[model samples]
Target: MTRSEVRTVLLDAVRELRPEFAGLRLTGNEHLGAELGLDSVARVELLVVLEEEFGIEDEVDPRIFMTPATVNALVDQIVVAEGVCR
Candidate 1:
């Protein structure tokens, strides 16, 4: 899927997982934890949702979760993992 499509899916998942983010205008550059207030547990949950949404099979690298401070970065990681480009 295209990056924009991926971003839309990701944002939908985020809204489903955290209703408080529903009306927020996310630029995909906002930090998931620090700026978005997602704790470790929430981060893991988000990762799980992404993996399921993207059909990722292998175990996701822990570093992937740690490094991405923004939703765009996280989407980049998913793109790489799914072997697709924008």
Candidate 2:
């Protein structure tokens, strides 16, 4: 899938985990944990959701989920890795 597609899927997953951020704007520079106030539990929840949605067993580091930009960047990397694996 393209980066845009990955972003859309990731955003949907995030919204599902945090309905409060459903309408919030998620830009490349936004911080997922700090800006959205997602604690460790919430971050794990998001990872689980993303795993299910993407259907890939990713080695998602906790630090990468610290921010929206980081998450986006990580997802991009994961998509490439998964594509390579496929």
Candidate 3:
């Protein structure tokens, strides 16, 4: 998927986990953990949601998506993973 497509999917996943961010705009630079206030638990939850959404749970490592990073960076990772995913 294109990065924009990945971003849309990521945004949806994040909104699903934290409804409060539904209206917020992600500039792709905001820190997932710090700016978004996604703690470890939330990050893990996000990971699960992302894996399910991307259908790459077995193809990619969950831990890779769990790291604290920007939404854009995560989108890059997801794009790469999906490109090579089963």
TM-score of each model, in listed order:
0.71, 0.60, 0.72
Name the candidate that leads on lDDT: 1
Better candidate number, 1 or 3, judged by lDDT = 1
Q: Arrange candidates, best TM-score first.
A: 3, 1, 2
Clashing pairs in 2: 32-68
- Please list the C-alpha lDDT of all candidates, in the order they appear: 0.72, 0.62, 0.70
Q: Candidate 3's error at 34, in angstroms? A: 1.4
Comparing 1 and 3 by TM-score, which wins? 3
- Full ranking by lDDT: 1, 3, 2
Per-residue alpha-carbon lDDT of candidate 2 for residues 1-86, written as tens digits (9 for 90 to 100): 46676677667766777788788877634566666566767766766776666575565554555444455675666555445223
Lowest summed lDDT across 10 adjacent residues in model 1 is found at: 56-65
Clashing pairs in 3: none
lDDT of 1 by residue, 1-86 (tens): 57887677767767777788898877888778777777777667776776687676455664566667777898798678755545
* Candidate 2 deviant stretches above 4 angstroms: 58-69, 77-86
RMSD of candidates 1 onward, in order: 2.5, 3.6, 2.7
